[model samples]
Target: MPSSTYLTPRLADLSVSERPQERLESQGPQSLSDSELLAMILRSGSKGRNVLSVASEILQESGSLNGLLKWSDAEFRAIKGIGKVKALQLITIVEICRRVRERSPVTAPILDSPDLVFDFMRQDTQNLEIEKFWTLCLNRKNRLIKKVEVTSGTASNSLVHPREVFREAIRQGASAVICAHNHPSGDPSPSAADIKVTRQLRESAKIVGIDLLDHLVVGNPEHDPLSRGYYSFQESGLL
Candidate 1:
């Protein structure tokens, strides 16, 4: 058989100017090819390959960087020269990219309908690995003033208190509030606890002098509840 890529020259043996690191530093990252960026991530390769060669092999097999999202740790490790550390690095890169996509400057909306509420928070909440509760504090005109996290809990459920939900709203001088929480199970069906919490918030809002516009549950559209993957208590007349 022809010699394995393991016998190829090490990445460090390449001309200094031609190296991925060197080019990235001198020419800016935008100047580099996708494989070159991944090469910097892979760092080096097995006996017959170099860093670029290994990164290229992975790209070819995976189709593109987006493919990395679908790959499990075991699948990453199965690639030649990829060990646990490298596999984790790739996975982390994918996660960082995903989170970056989620983050953006918050823009206020009219908050007049369930669809507006759902789309406003969906970008921040989709594909979460655990439950997270957030309160959207809005002004009297229904313009969003702030979107803040109240609590992050386990995969299936998050325990939240009315105090925790309204404390920030009160502090921000919000006239009304919208509560939202994700279901890691992707089922938007509200639990007894969910109903109880909504009623509790409703009662607390009456005392605090602020309206509870809605309590929205975010989940998978496939799980049921009209296949919308979201529920608004205000829309359903639950609140």
Candidate 2:
């Protein structure tokens, strides 16, 4: 028989200072990195790699936490170190986020200012690989009623149409709407196409008796790799 004894060491081989669990319990969750937080949920790894390494690898494989939101349960389990329980945990988190996003938006402040609007949406689209167009529909009081994603794709073509934007706004009974999109290029500067599309949507809104309040472009204004900075057309008087 081949050597039955498993010579490979386990996570215990690492010092307590290097262990995610110990560090977390001692230092608190906020002190840890994203991988450490994820590793806490994962709890274990494959025979050779430890939980922290597994979590770091998973983050790299799936991209950021936002990117992980796109993965399926099977995809999570398919990773070498993750198993059924870890996969279920990850899936549960994703479903909870989905539910959170679906709730009504009116509880928040009126999204009248472009800066406020950008803050409202940067979470969903900032680090995305592709462009995404969103509409924030608001009531007469300017409180948000619903936020909808119209389209997503490459920078050149997101296929955002006035019909899609207004149809949702009308369905949501919104008196006015705010438009927003992210530029993966990290440049918040408006493209000629961006200006043209905003004007088109504004005209359509006028005809439909719905107001187009502002259009926002999200990007990395600070040139920071980890942050998705933004720009506002209304703030710059381009809308």
Candidate 3:
């Protein structure tokens, strides 16, 4: 094996000709690899490993950038060389990325398409270990205003309430909202409780003047919710 003291040639290790920072400054962020982008966040490696090695380990263990974002702090900390501080650091970076994505211009015109709803929610909610209810507040034009986490739990109806859903919509001056939740079991099949909560939210939105556009249940694409003939409120005539 190579000497444990050898520092890996990560972005930080490159000279002005080879570094990601230099390349990004001269070229652009798109010029960098996934590991290079992640290495930039990692900054430095532990004693034996360099940032590239650390980034590789993270990618390998987590499976992908999406997988990295999906990992809990506890799961990240379980990595051989990662500790609590590093785990927090990794999660914080992911959180910032999420917020930035959330705040990005809604240049893409919103549609009533359930696929759009699924794509939007998949950016953050798909791989959560616990159930989380999210409300996507939209303007009259159907453009996104904001996305809020209403509640989190194991069961859909256990934590989500109509009051909490509409309160934020009213505060944001939203004309409509889309309710969504993720299934960690990789089945996007909406439960009976999901339907019940959605019905309640739809009624509340009616009373509050905020239209309920749709309620989407998301699971991993690998699992084939649609092909598996999972529940879609629109398809089921529940919407």
Candidate 4:
């Protein structure tokens, strides 16, 4: 709907002041809308469509600019004007954004609650197309000691062993640990495998004399059935 505000069918028809690049130079990047910013990335359009229209199509396909974080190369190429090279370019930019967003804090965060855990881990999970499990080692105060990736697996399942989960935590001298993984489908609801793995971890934690604080399933709230964005094992009284 925002793209409809552009009366001209092509960027060539717009005055220099009205153009996205010109507007960005004169008024700064913040002055331009989401579609305008995307147009700048796209650079040019196909024979019939303008770059603004192509950019608008991209936004509509992804649902929002933020939604582009989860998009794959094939998804970008499915758009009208986005070819292989453009899709690759888009993928590179998206990966850069994810890296910038997921960069760990200079001072580690206190990841006590499920909300805090979700906020801390979501960016790492954002562009993942498969399930990957990670362990967050926490000090007595619930501040992070270290974060470790335990296993990487398919879209539907990840093979996690309790030893793999606790080995790094023990090595780091962590007092407690939180384990987390992403759902590629964007629903954080735990699977049978997730429940089984949590139980195994809990029992093993008792033997290892370490706390199994929580197990989180990270996902996008937009696609989640509960719209809660993430599922926590401790919150459900399973930990």
- Which numbered prediction scores highest in lDDT against the true structure? 4
Models 1 onward score TM values of 0.56, 0.54, 0.53, 0.57
lDDT of 4 by residue, 1-239 (tens): 24465443777677898799999988999999999999999999876778998999899989998899999999999998899999999999999998888994688899999999999998899989999999999999999999999999997788999999999999999999999999999999999989999999999999999999999999999988989889999999998
| lDDT tens digits, residue span 8-91, model 2 | 335577678877778888998887889988888887767666677788888998998778878999989878878888789899
lDDT (tens digit, per residue) of candidate 1 on 160-219: 999999999999999999999988877878899999999999999999999999999987
| Local error of candidate 2 at residue 50 (angstroms) | 41
- Give the alpha carbon lDDT tens digit for every residue of 1-239 in model 3: 25544656434445786676677788889998888788777776776677777877888888889887678889878765678888898889888877787778757558477877776677686457888878888998998888889888874333688998888889999999888878877687777788788788878877888888888787776676455312457656776
Compared with the true structure, all predictions reach lDDT values of: 0.87, 0.80, 0.76, 0.92
In terms of lDDT, which candidate is stronger, 2 or 3?
Answer: 2
RMSD of each: 7.7, 12.0, 10.2, 11.6
* Each candidate's clash count: 7, 0, 0, 0
For model 1, where is the 10-residue window of minimal lDDT? 1-10
Candidate whose TM-score is highest: 4
Candidate 2's TM-score reads: 0.54
lDDT (0-100) at residue 118 of candidate 3?
A: 77
| Candidates by lDDT, descending order | 4, 1, 2, 3
